[model samples]
Target: MAEPAGGPPRAGLVSVVIPARNAEATIAVQLDALYRQTYPGPWEAVVVDNGSSDGTRAVLRSWQRRMPQLRPVSAPEASGANHARNIGCRLASGELVLCCDADDIVAPGWMAAMVETLRTSPAAGGALERRSLNGTVALAARPPKESDSLLDTFGFLPYPAGANCGFHKELWRRLGGFDESYRYGSDDVEFFWRAQLAGYELGFSPHAVVHYRLRDGPLAIARQLYCYGRSHPRLYRDFRAYGMPRSRIGEAVRAWWRLLVHAGDLAATPERRSAWLAGLALRAGRVAGSVRHRRPYL
Candidate 1:
């Protein structure tokens, strides 16, 4: 049986912040999922349109009628997603904030699970790994579609998909929200690392799930990888002293080795090949970024 409204939402109200950039094609799906959350409490969705030239704003405005809780804001001069997120956070009235993506679809009960995690944790600040308030993060799976139940997220790019994660609004303010200077990825990573150093404890919610969209097409993957690679150096620059590893230094060589070993096997399937090519592009971008930034990143 489902826990009543008295279950794990002891935490204060939740504010879902979504940063959108020309996402008219899919924002409605996300909004629909948000509207269906079962947590019967005060909650709001904040959407920040970051210089979108399309009908994105129109779509958002239309949704506002149905979801009065959905607040729409614009960052016409902003340059990155993080910037938009920061803006949305500032406009938020809820003490608890959830950073959701404009394209992904969150599962039902996700909000409650996240709230439970924070409300029941032993500390004031922490992250939930899976979807249960008291769930063991050590046994959680990898980021959305990366892998199936990877045990520990220590090695992979696992630190709670920013799109599906939530936190106390005060913490967001204290940490200054996400770094808006970045034009690419890793902004979430940077914030998460800094938060951990600031003594935030992480919780796991096995039920708080979001169906994340993966970059797949050749050009799409390449662009995503390039941006991700380019942004990585910034993360290191900001958090190396806080223990962000330097393993990225040999990323290219390792990537090549993996390619050599799995070339034939990967060719056996179109999906595998597509992913393999994306990995190669990412490695290339990583190497280029290291040289460009004069950092031992790739």
Candidate 2:
């Protein structure tokens, strides 16, 4: 890496591509956080709306004066974040592209940290924190584990969450962007895995933090985890040829057995009940996914 005189490392215009759909409630907070960034380089935020049926567009319109660097566009033709992200990345006129969710808040030095990290690495993932945005119930349902520098998936190469990751624009073009077929979950996982298979190194930056929002309530948590569970088999099916390991039957049996043992425990606390519902939903989804994707993961 080269630096000019006493200045920081060389960096170009960074386009922060955000994919949004009906994010009228939380987008403003994320946008406000972006506005308060401490990165000294030139950057712009291109928010692609994926068929928002609410006041999402209206909210973006209202923020024009407040954030002149903000560029709001439409990708209503597609129905997923991957599609919206592809459109936004294509339209972004920057050397680097940093992606974040419309609902999460980024740290003040996030951009700077990411920029610094990418100077040496081709792709990088930012750390995620849950306590800032989630309450005890949400946290209880999905307890926060300390995040690893790289995320492990089914014994395959580690990858990053799409909510906080970035890469050079050339790499995006080379990889053909994210696969839209993964409409719900594991889009990020698949993309980063493909990148690694294509010979690009994926890195992580703890300094670049994102306050991640969790799905609250048992219903919401169950639904989200179910979707996640469904995606796992699909991922396994797609990557197993490349040496991705299969789920252990012994582990799966123990999981279900434990759930069965506690099935009639009406005296369980709300937090414990929430965990039970999440576990049941995820297992059911894995079974459904095994049938749907023709790959047995559970």
lDDT of predicted model 1: 0.68
Worst lDDT run of 10 residues, candidate 1, spans 133-142
User: Which regions of candidate 1 deviate over 4 angstroms?
Assistant: 1-11, 121-158, 248-252, 260-269
Question: RMSD of candidate 1 to the true fold?
Answer: 7.9
TM-score of 2: 0.94
Error (Å) of candidate 2 at residue 110 is: 0.7
Best by lDDT: 2
Candidate 1 structure, TM-score to reference: 0.81
Q: After superposing candidate 2, which stretches have Cα over 4 Å from the reference? A: 1-11, 265-267
Q: Over the stretch 17-41, how does candidate 1's per-residue lDDT look in tens digits? A: 8989888988999899899999988
